[model samples]
Target: MMSRIPTDAIRACVEHTGWTEQEVRNVLGNVIAETPDALLEALPEVIAWAKRIEDSAALVSIMKELPRGVLEITWNGTEPAIRIRPSCDVRQVPEGWEIVLPDEKRHAST
Candidate 1:
């Protein structure tokens, strides 16, 4: 069965990639910086197996991205599917994860 995706999954992915968050952040920033208009929305429900399964290697086995938004991830863990919405209430943020709300339209950057 698939596992649920947790905010901590970000760190797991970091560990699996053997890359620091700053590095990944920089890479992603560079890739998306030029295309700020790009909306790379992820279902996350697909790659959520990492939450229940502790083995990163095995986790990678069932991790597969079917499309830009859909993922087909599975592992020897319990990753129950769930509904994700942009307008949903925010869950508690995990360690090392920060929830940044979009800037107010009326407020200018300091």
Candidate 2:
């Protein structure tokens, strides 16, 4: 069965990322739909990462692809770069960035 994402989490994402409630719900809902077990475990991390980037579009793009693969953030450059990669293909995550959604967890790379 699919799990419902917590409303509080949605609200937090909206507040932190400057995205509308609907936008937060849409991205999170899609992710939860794809991975029922990841709801609670992934929500906090999602919000934290969202707060690090000022680009709502980029964050949305990252969240949308999370369920399909792994999310990789690289902060070594002048600006953070986010991307998605197949779970099986993830390498050692670099410094200043974390990899999300690998194996049991899922989400991006570049």
Candidate 3:
């Protein structure tokens, strides 16, 4: 089952970051544009999975994409299906083998 970015999640972000709803909407608008509803729905799970893999940088980067740098989701041709682009230091998470990465490429995964 697919999950979506909840209104409360966005509200929480706005409250924590002190950003206006419009600002949040602008970023979310771009996000929706790129991947559409399904991926956005999967955002929370994707983030949790990223945390499980210790890819905090990626999570932060995804959140910081005001003008750009937004997490770009794509099909990996696998069951994990969704792939996040602009992933810096790619590391594979065993569950569904999702590729998670930090913001910068410090070391290459072998």
Candidate 4:
């Protein structure tokens, strides 16, 4: 998948979103140039298609209604989807937020 951080796309997002172009450019450029592994690890979390984490309260309600266990959230990004293992007990998901289930223990994948 093509990354959204391409120069023209980033410039577009900045102009469309009314964000500081300089800030966006610096953050995007530095992440691409400095720490590749960190960027790879976090790419799934903050892609262009992530259901804007800006709406947490509503998401909490949605999570509360869904049956407990693993949920796969498909968003637009290079990879296209992210699977989250949320804590079983959560009633409402914090909106615009996908909190990593606190009790989730990451087992090394083979």
Best by TM-score: 2
Model 3, position 40, has a per-residue lDDT of: 65
Encode model 3's per-residue lDDT on 1-110: one tens digit a residue.
11255677767656754668676555555443344466566555544453444455655565564223224544467523333456543455766334445534324322
lDDT of each: 0.38, 0.61, 0.50, 0.50
- TM-score to native of every candidate shown: 0.23, 0.38, 0.28, 0.25
How far residue 106's Cα lies from its native spot in candidate 4, in Å, is 46
Candidates 1 and 4 compared: the better one by TM-score is: 4
Candidate order (TM-score): 2, 3, 4, 1
What TM-score does structure 2 among the candidates reach? 0.38
Query: RMSD of model 1, in Å?
Result: 20.9
Which portions of model 1 miss their true places by more than 4 Å?
A: 1-9, 33-110
Clashes in predicted model 3: 2
Which scores greater on lDDT, model 1 or model 3? 3
Per-model C-alpha RMSD: 20.9, 16.2, 14.9, 13.3
Q: State the displacement of the C-alpha of residue 88, model 4, in Å, after optimal TM-score superposition.
A: 34
Q: For each predicted model, how many residue pairs clash, with residues at least 3 apart or on different chains?
A: 4, 14, 2, 12
In candidate 1, how many Å is residue 21 off?
1.1
lDDT of 1 by residue, 1-110 (tens): 01222436546656765657664344344332223323123323322333334355554453432112223233446654433324323346767433333344113322
